[model samples]
Target: MNSKSRVVVWSTGGVGSIAIDAIRHRPDLELVGVWVHSADKVGRDAGELAGGTALGIAATDDAEALIGLRPDCVVYAASGPERDAGAVPDYLRLLGEGINVVSTSSTSLVYPPSYFHPEWRKQLESAAEAGGASFYASGVFPGFGSDQLALLLATQSKTIRTLTVREIALNDHYPVADVMMDGMGFGRPLEFEPMLSTPGFIEMAWSAPIQLIAKALGAQVLQIRGSLDRRVTDRDLEVAFGTIAAGTCGAVCTRAAGVVDGREAIVVEHIIRMARDVAPDWKTSDSDATYQVDIDGDPDIHCSLTLGDAEGHGAGRGAMAATAMRVVNAVPYVVDAAPGLLSSLDLPITLPRNVLE
Candidate 1:
């Protein structure tokens, strides 16, 4: 703790940009480098990429160059079709270099012990141990709200029946083209199958949270079940990404539940809408995005957390900042944690009081 932790931001897309800005606001951390895959961003200033004032640091495509910097940690936020395939290699090299990593890409790593890949899990642990580093992955929905937040709310219950984490997001404000169209099938016909609708995708994406919460409650998951329901818009819908035809799919509700003690005990569900008027029958959020935890047990507790801006509107930017800060703020804890795969269960999470709205 005597010296500031030198940090590097991997990727300037999405959460990475916000991580760069969040790092600058913290006095205890230093931005050393940024890694990007795009050519146009190769020599751009870090601050410019983050949509802020100029920072002397420049973004680079060189992996070894950043590795050579010997940063205390790296915020890995690069995401794609096969997240594990693209992220694992980078994580291995970073951990092997004795540098810790806080990531938003691999959702399963939110709980290290329950990582989906058994072989890669051992390799990650070995590499981390060899280099004396740690690796943690988290995000707002698949990360904190699904696992840590649900378990946190459970502390108030003496007798537990069922635990559920619901994410109700209004996606109209989010304008990511690839995600909105191809990833979520927002503008596609009912016959189209996007990543969210692909077989085993829901379980792969969400089972970790369900199983993590199950294990914490002293039970093993006998099975994990996934379900997806998509509804079509009644009329032509205009969205930030594109248009949702009247007869095309416009909304989706996906759920993953863990069977514990011969019952469905832990569940993580997402209720997403391209427009507010698209899904009236489904659960809705007060703000643009809401993470609600429902504990159906003794002294049942229902807590609703809505992300909003200063203007009282739930904006997507606020959620992006939160996701970035989740890992950026955890850098100090990850750096001091034991050299291995750390999880929400392993490290003491910190909340910086100085973070802005």
Candidate 2:
């Protein structure tokens, strides 16, 4: 019998927990270790922590201990707000140790060579070459649902003019306080500058998708521009994270556009709200949280994707699952790839294993 691929799940948060569940259930993969950041989760069973039955594996906060196990691949699902200083080194260390990586921690790394700083890119490239390991970064939005899926749909078009991808989500159901409240400034004063509004923040965050789409279409992006706007709530609202009182920031609309030859050729927009009613004037999905792609071409195509459990996991949790699964499903392809940084454009079509069974 062929041996299963040894894997370790790094972190167990919104996305990491889902990755743990995926690794544990896959027949072709073996869950060897789990890395945690919190002291409270250090000794807990990986399965139990991931909202599933107990698995034999235990979680640990010690990064060195997990690295010592020398797993074939590491599924990196750590959160990425204000973590660049530490996260980049961690990725380099893992790659330098000859362990391949499939990660959702850094969206910018989705197409690093095109958008990331040259110094950081050089470090990662040298590490992967020296260790003979590969690194691939992805997530639901910057990964498949936006870039890859849009490119696939474009293949059917007779002519192409412009493409726009939008992510409309109800943040009330999203549980991450650091991301929803702090990073997004969801409940802050209207005048406050959330992390997303910082200069170049939107361009950096959404550059991967814009670049990916622009490259796929053989278009050179001459410039990238971004915009951010927000709305205040009229009433106090309770959410999974906390409470958003009246007269506070309750919704955010942001967009990054890629310009080619003095025209906006590709764009990625995010319309997120603490409640459905907060952004009633803005476009929304048919479901609570939706990803929509619109193509303005000869055929003029529009695609919408909604992932959530109508009966079980809510839209927020379901979106997290989709993000985690996108990384998990790419593990095999990443593992077999040549040693270096990889983008969705370079990878083969990846599908979930044993999803039907």
Candidate 3:
């Protein structure tokens, strides 16, 4: 425990890049290696890929090769399939090789004791037990404000009748633009699937967090539903970043519901859009960017969070990294966690006033 831990980063996407930056800033962690899925980035320096100067860590696509480096811990920023079906298995493989893990994949991994793949949890637990390693996961708005915020509000309630969580975000970008287009009902020639499975869609990303809050509040999820709509540019519309067709307005709506003792006690909503303000019916100001969270209980509570300038939107990147860093730093605690799925509520955690500060 006295020695600095050697760590490997498993991807170089936005989350991965931010994670590498956060890792480099940590004195206790040594970023000895990085893994990228692209062949083009194989020989590049991790620092360069992360928008920093050369840090001597090379990016390689060889997952098995990085595994051979025998890092004490691996910070996985890889997403998608890895998050859904491969997270626990990948953790198990690394644990089997005596490597601990912290990831930004499972956003709601931090709350409610049961918000995970049960079988996967068992696999990770068995592997960790056999190899004496640890695994943890968290990130961004999904990781923090939703799960953590809801859980925090639950503490003020005595006889909680119902819980509602809503998340809104604008001015966000992702590497996967096609997924974004499809999810937003944009680039696609036709609207096919809901936003549930598309990348960069908050609805898809918010599911676990909603589940986390529900489980923490002891609500049994009855059903989950989602929807999406977009406004296509009639003509090419020009913006600061680039020109978009008059159409290109991306929007999504999602909801998850749960029942407590046959009463609908929990509902979560996520809304993502690219408009000046929410429509009049949704009841949002026609002003600058903002965020809001309203918690209704026996006492009836309400909270609103707003972010205005570039700095406000930029805060999300740092927020994402900070969530991962905080969760990663708790690897030792994760190592001692009981078998099976776990959450922030399952552990003794003092959420720092500002995750990165």
The 0-to-1 C-alpha lDDT of every candidate, in the order given, reads 0.86, 0.85, 0.62
User: Mind giving the per-residue lDDT tens digits that candidate 1 earns over 64-170?
Assistant: 99999999999999977688899999999999999999999898888877677989999999999999999988889887778778888888899888888999888
| Cα lDDT, model 1, residue 168 | 89
lDDT of 3 at 97: 79
Better of 1 and 3 by TM-score: 1
In model 1, which regions exceed 4 Å deviation?
Answer: 176-178, 310-314, 353-357
Query: What's each prediction's clash count?
Result: 0, 0, 9
lDDT string, candidate 2, 9-42, tens digits: 9898879988888888899788999998889998
Winner on TM-score between 1 and 2 is 1
lDDT computed for candidate 3: 0.62
Query: Candidate 1 — which pairs collide?
Result: none
Error of 3 at 6 (Å): 2.8
lDDT value for candidate 1? Answer: 0.86
